[model samples]
Target chain A: MATLMDRVITSKAAVLEGSRAIAEAVRLCRPQVISAYPITPQTHVVEALAQMVADGALKAEFVNVESEHSAASVVLGASATGARVYTASSSQGIALMSEVLFNIAGLRLPVVLTCANRALSSPLNIWNDQQDSLSVRDAGWVQLYVEDNQEAVDTHLQAYAIAEDRRVLLPTMVCADGFLLTHTYEPVIVPTQEEVDAFLPPYRPQHYLTPDKPLTMGAFADPEYYMESRYLLDRALERSQAVIEDAAQRFNRAFGRHYGGLLDTLHMEGARTAVVAMGSVVATLRDVVSGLRDDGHAVGLVKVRSFRPFPKDALRSALRDVDRVLVLERALSPGGVGILAAEVRAVLQGQPRQPAVSAFVAGLGGRDIPVETLQALIARAQDEAVEQGFADLKAELVEEGDEDES
Target chain B: MKTRVEPAPELLSPGHTACRGCGLLVAARLALQAAGPRVIVANATGCLEITTSKFPQSSWNVPWIHSLFENTAAVASGVEAALKALGRQAEARVIAQAGDGGTADIGLQSLSGMLERGHDVLYICYDNEAYMNTGIQRSSLTPLGARTSTTPPGALSWGEVRTKKDMPAIAAAHGIPYVATASIAYPPDLVKKVKRALGIRGPKYLQVHSSCPLGWGHDSSLSIRVARLAVQTGLYPLYEVINGQLTNVKRLSYRSPVAAYLKPQRRFEHLFKPGGEALLAQVQALANANAAKYGFPPVTEGAEAEDSD
Candidate 1:
């Protein structure tokens, strides 16, 4: 007779189903509290876990909060009291919870959140993109982007380890492409329960409510103290990159899976041309790299994983050898260049012999980016670098009349 | 030492920077006394948060946290939840305190959420009628015809045109276990309400009329006297709502006219000046209506223990 754990494992191998993989990963982490609200695309992640809790597959306290703000607050409260807490939201849900998001980080609560990247609403489009997470880039969270279902599951498991590390007791966001990574089905290899238990330990709050050792978690800081409080938070965030790298390295050794660093470089060896991107687009870029390589083009791809500490040194190293680098951003920074483009440029400033970095602001508001378009962008950047040297390149829309005349 | 049932220890100590005779200080001290030492206060960004906690200093003897401008209820809810999870629920009581601006305007949503979720927490709103910290800006709870930084007395307008927000009624609408309005002038009643709220099972809201001298433009020494005048005039009536039903109104003896409350504060001075008698009359009418609705019996001179069913 098989045991209960075996009975639940109908499909033994790792499945690459989008939201299910995320749910499975969270289950592996075994969070004590899960507070969530229903938001489009992101709802399935929490809903699946809720069902698991009800079905006795996951033993957890699933708090059905009324709004996104309360959901974040519930998790913060639960996490502060030393319970491992998890929550998921998207788009306006994130915006609604923005005030508490800063408090959670400022208080240094190690809560793990999953953001199903979606567009902020005015016309209310609930689909896929990076606008939501990028908008809160200054919120002092360790942001990690996942390329696929496997990474989504793996990253969430790793997020807990990194976030709860004594040196980096801060909140983290596991950002996945909405619908693309949330709804799509794929094969994912889930680790055994015993293996996961060994990989990630139980949460132990550094400064929780204890009668034996009384301490204040969040206190009012006046002008003289407020600046130092913020400075400490900034220092903690800057120190998280090393913690993330160490956790990822340990996770790889234990599970036999390797994710490079805060920034991951791909096919950049001896390449003078590259396209820098994040999230699901990295998979598309990998395909583009293969197509370009088959056509005898020296092109590579760079994927940013840790977005908060930003991995400036790693990015500089990745782009140092490349003569031309094209940046693809899925979110706009309004009147300025795209958020990622601005950050990459800031990192490259005054560096020794930098690449001619060009920006392609595409796939915004859930707009799909085909492999063909990504290839064309790479080709355009190479041509622009050859013609304009190190001059900045903007997206050039192809005129319809010109194509018709041709 | 005087023998008394109340603990003599000062939970909210002296040397704090509340204005002379500031009713908020008295209310805070009495409420903290009633709550005792094992209390965790979640203070919102307001006058209390500013004056009590000024960089490497704190007036509270109990553990406290000062969250953002709003969401003290939410933060308090978290503290309660944390305590419950840690199996130390009985060790301390969670109390969220904020000003009228933070409570009635910006924090209503979070407060509602806390009450609806049935968290074991007590929220206190120190109602000084305006945003005292941001230089006395008009807030939702600021009474009508009061001159504030935002609602100035101009040629076209007398002062604030809108009446004070009915916060206790709104809180009662949340179906909380206990909801009450108390004045700093009635310290014993305020302390009793605080003790009652702490014993409740679910969320409780106490709206205390804490007089602000700077915002009201009153003589600093007359803050408590002004607060007492408000209750005597029936402008700021003391009442309690239990389980969504009105009960136990502290009807004063010898109910004074609205002028007794209006004359002392410069914020309400505009209502008494030239062509402002209409606004004053409107304020009087509102006070009468409140007294009648809450069954506030007119107090007679030297008469005590007035009660009506």
Candidate 2:
């Protein structure tokens, strides 16, 4: 019930669920239109924003759509009309929105979305995993993964800045681990409206749907022009890397907190073994790496923040001196290797003194990746040639052929 | 002095790829003429979108967007929200449009959401019966006894056995402010309904029966005649359901036989085959029921009736 001025003057940290943190950041960004469908893990984010709109706390239109497909479409339309828009979904919802996700990016709308990342359904599990957002890796959106609640908040504010930059002008998805980040309550410093307004200006799209200047969008391109259009989209995403770094630096200048450009590293100073990961699992990796460094094991952690632009150069340089790089990931290609690990290997391939890049899939379908498993993985990387395997598989818990439960 | 009817400002330019007698384009042109230049259109992926706005060559003189096939209504909701947020709602009206497939089948849920939310937008469905843009696949709106690529008649089966989905009734069920049915044959009526829908504040739906020369296997020049025959036959009735109440029904002065409507199109050519009598009679019975339901004139003997076959 505090006034805007009172909150600005008393800018203090408050304990909040990660979803509420995202909602608070969205409110500060002043999205003119917010649309979303209630899905597991991501529901609370939109629920909070909906309550804020109802209570006159946020002056935005909260469009309650039928499904995630419509939710994404609503935001895409809103964005094309020169309005700052926000939406959120997870897991199956993201899968349902795959078509529209590609359409939004192809149309070059600077809409921002939050993915409360969850495992895809086969067994219909509603647990935390990075598979959903990572599944739409080639949707041409700037995908940023957050490690914790505060980072989730900061990354959202940064997302709007990064997406709306004229040079970028592509949709951005801020992926935070479902249940891990979305359900857990953590102390987060919510920025004031004035500060957010200063950091992120009003969205002024170069091309938009306005009667004053009639324009056509989402027109189908023939083969003659389709490849060039895709090439341009790729260039735009690649250009987004500089904008992402610049936004991070400016965010640090304004808020005095930093999420390193592209990828952030910890304890990589002259370390022989490095563990690469993303999302909330990186927080666990940080703890395990610090312990190993204290014990003089020469282990480090490379937290990949930007997954879409792939942070290929930043990762290559970060893992250049390492003797071995263990790529731990929460998502995999099912028939292939870890999604992030494969990309890491491709980026580090044929480099001078290329480090050994190993793929390790862990914490899938919301399985807890505790410090013991992290330590075991590091030990395996040190002793054996760990190519690509599940990190925390329970052999005794498996009943072979149980998957065919028909 | 002759009263001059100034032609509706051409919002849709000519250099597009729609067929020679595309009933959908005719309906769109008339509706857009009524909605005028001060409108932003959210179009679904269909014949209208594909033909009019091929990349780098758009026929639209108004601001327009074509997203996926099934999300036009939801997209228009976003456009309306954005306009409302920008305080430009008064300057530009919003229209979401799609083919019957996009409206009655794939896009129904999003359409329902847009209507339920009461966004101040007009959703227009150009009902050409089947998925004409996708090489004549059967859609939910494909009428009974008509043939499509997916619903082709064979030795054991009749084509498209299911009745067309009642989309206007579905729109009216949401308790929206307005829901109407129009035809390209009735240009003035279609234009009037479009303008009226745009003048209203909340969600409105207008389903225009647009005949497809290609899909229907009718002569391109007889497109309007075929559309008119549809209305006269009462198979595709022209009416309005306002605020959930049946308000207006365009009465047929000269009621035509269902055969007069169906016999010309190759899609229904099977109905004239040697063993196709019973299904043809069923088609007539449908028309009779529609006429009875909408209070149209009864089928008088020899009145607008074509060949006995």
Q: Among these predicted structures, which one has the highest DockQ?
A: 2
As a whole number from 0 to 100, the lDDT of residue B264 in candidate 2 is 81
All models, DockQ values?
0.45, 0.82
Residue-level lDDT of model 2, residues B39-60, one tens digit each, is 9999999999999988889999
- Candidate 1 clashes between residue pairs 3 or more apart in a chain or in different chains: A14-A188, A14-A189, A15-A187, A15-A188, A16-A186, A16-A187, A16-A188, A17-A186, B253-B299, B254-B299
List TM-scores for all candidates, in order.
Answer: 0.91, 0.96
Q: State the lDDT of candidate 1 residue by residue for B124-222, as single tens digits.
A: 999999999899999999998999999999989898999998999888888889999988777778878999999888899999998988999999887
User: What CAPRI class is candidate 1?
Assistant: acceptable
Counted clashes in each candidate structure: 10, 0
Model 2 - which docking category?
high
DockQ of 1: 0.45
Which digits, one per residue and each the tens of the lDDT, describe model 2 over residues A1-406? Answer: 1001111213488989999989999999999999999999999999999999999999998898999999999999999999999999999999999999999999999889999999998989899888899989999999999998988999999999999898988999999999999999988899999999999998888889998999999889999899999999999999999999999999989988887878888888888988999999988887798888889899888889999898888888888898898888798787887788889889988899678777788888999998998898888887655567787677567765332111
Residue B303's lDDT within candidate 2 is: 61
Off by over 4 Å in 1: A1-11, A14-16, A56-59, A209-217, A220-226, A386-406, B1-5, B298-309
